[model samples]
Target: MVSCVALLGGSYDPVHAGHVALAALFADLLQPDQLRIVPAGDPWQKAPLQADAADRVAMLALAFEAARLPIVIDRQEIERHGPSYTIDTLKNVRATLGPGASLVFLMGADQLMQLDSWRDWHALFDYAHLGVAARPGYSLAAASLPPAVAAEITVRQGSLEQLRTTPSGRIYLAETLAVDISATQIRAALRDDDQASLAACSLIPPVVLDYIQQHHLYKN
Candidate 1:
């Protein structure tokens, strides 16, 4: 069987249950040899992160502690100095994995729609297969994407079998259970001392929530 590595990159400012659930879902669907959760060091496209990198990493470790599969906390992007571009990260991972190992780059349906705007987005397929997770009410069909992305989708889309066997140049859409949770809302709840909101959402892991309270994070 071909060795496979799945990459799921995000800020993970304070890794929540939703993130954990998504990782677990992908692990079951892809069955990669390793699933790496990469935290962004400096995400150029988004606002500045609220928590420090070390704190985020620590929370991620705790959040994924009970995961069914062994999930790795890849700190390469967090340790790097400049902006964290997906293409650069993918290239580095590809080089480390060599040519034979299959690489899967995981993303949400929202990211898929905005993929054309990413830096060197077209070349991403060269290094890893795109595994887009379906989000609630978001369409993964090619017709719904931008012209360039639709064209690529039409040509590079592949089945689960091809994704499992081939090393690269395939786009696979995996259906996942809808977990309507966001780090933004979690942070806001922390800031506002809204236990009701947090409990209602039920997205933050207990350990992670304890860490956040211990560190007094996201109280801005």
Candidate 2:
């Protein structure tokens, strides 16, 4: 049997409740040994992140508390120069875990569809298995993809045992709790009041909200 590791990396500019909720769900469903909230530094493939690594790392520490599952704020990517490629991160994690350690990278359904666009994406499957997050209105069939990559994906029913001793480098669709909150709306609220919902409609936690207030984020 192999020790399972769940890697959840992102540019947590202002870690919100959505992130917190997802982490908890991932821990509960997959029950991995560690849930890593990797703060992305200079990602090579995408545009520069919104906030600096330090700020994002700080916010992540603040968002995650003892109440949440054991989520480690891994800094490997933050310390690395150049792009924060998933493949690089996976390799580092796999090396640390040694052989038989199942590396599972967690992501939302929307991001899963775009996996083919990532740098050395095909190789990522070689390094780690995938945990496709389940969200409302997120259809696996509708996730537009290249025929070749699409054929390679495997959708699971999101069971804890199913993931316990599964094959390496396979994709698992984790059907756990889903919080449909968008950060764009949160940012827009700072500039102009949200027309669709109230200010508290944001999934961001109060502490993050307070920090953003203190720092005057999203303000010109």
Candidate 3:
């Protein structure tokens, strides 16, 4: 039987270390039958990502190749002509997984803070469970939040074992994985030919680093 899975969606704008770290940690905690890495084609909430869909997918595939974990490159939104809503992505995964499969939609703390602003945010809960990752130096307190976000939460706690039973998308506190890295910093370093910044950056997966060197990405 195919198992319930967790869905991690993003632009993967450049598929940085933070993205990979979340994938690794969540895979460990959820122990999903499978973990789908769905990269958005054109995210509506955020600006259009710098990397194209094909490149982003290739980079992610390379980054996760060592583990051989089942990472599906879901392109439902990429195919669509308009904005990519989380609800749409969730709906597609729900259909693929069926009713028995428990799906979790993963997001960072920043996304959760603006959860109320998402289109049909409440409806998304019907499709999958949620895994809200902690941002660097972020606290997951629900106090002072709008009732919609606060009451709807299924806060997570306890050991990895408890994670499976926890409500979806409830705040899941995690140590900063892959360190504090940003796509912008990586791009800047690439532009300036700054070896120190590139070396210090926690953004690139080693394989991705090699790929960047070979392809000379971001050379303007």
Q: How does each model score on lDDT? A: 0.84, 0.71, 0.71
| Reference-based TM-score of each model | 0.94, 0.85, 0.86
Please give the range of 10 consecutive residues that has the lowest summed lDDT in model 3: 154-163
Q: What is the C-alpha lDDT profile of model 2 across 1-220, one tens digit per residue?
A: 3488777887775577777777777787777777777878776655566666777777787788654456678899889877788888888887877867767788887677677888888788777777777766665653455665577773333345645565356777666656676666666676665556446535677777777778767664
Among all windows of 10 consecutive residues in model 2, the one with the lowest summed lDDT is: 154-163
Which pairs clash in the backbone of model 1? none
How big is the positional error of residue 16 in model 1, measured in Å on the Cα after superposition?
1.9
Candidate 1 C-alpha lDDT tens digits along 1-220: 3388888899887787767777777788878888888999999888899999889999988888876766788889988889999999999888888988888888888789899999999999999999888778778887887889889888998987788788899998777557667788888888775568657335788888889889989889
lDDT of 2: 0.71
lDDT tens digits, residues 57-128, model 3?
888888878753676778788888888888988887777767766676777776777889999887776666
Comparison by lDDT, 1 against 3, better one? 1
Rank list by TM-score:
1, 3, 2
* Stretches > 4 Å off in candidate 2: 44-46, 142-145, 154-162, 193-201
Query: In terms of TM-score, which candidate is strongest?
Result: 1
Candidate 1: worst-modelled 10 consecutive residues by lDDT: 193-202
lDDT of 2 at 153: 71
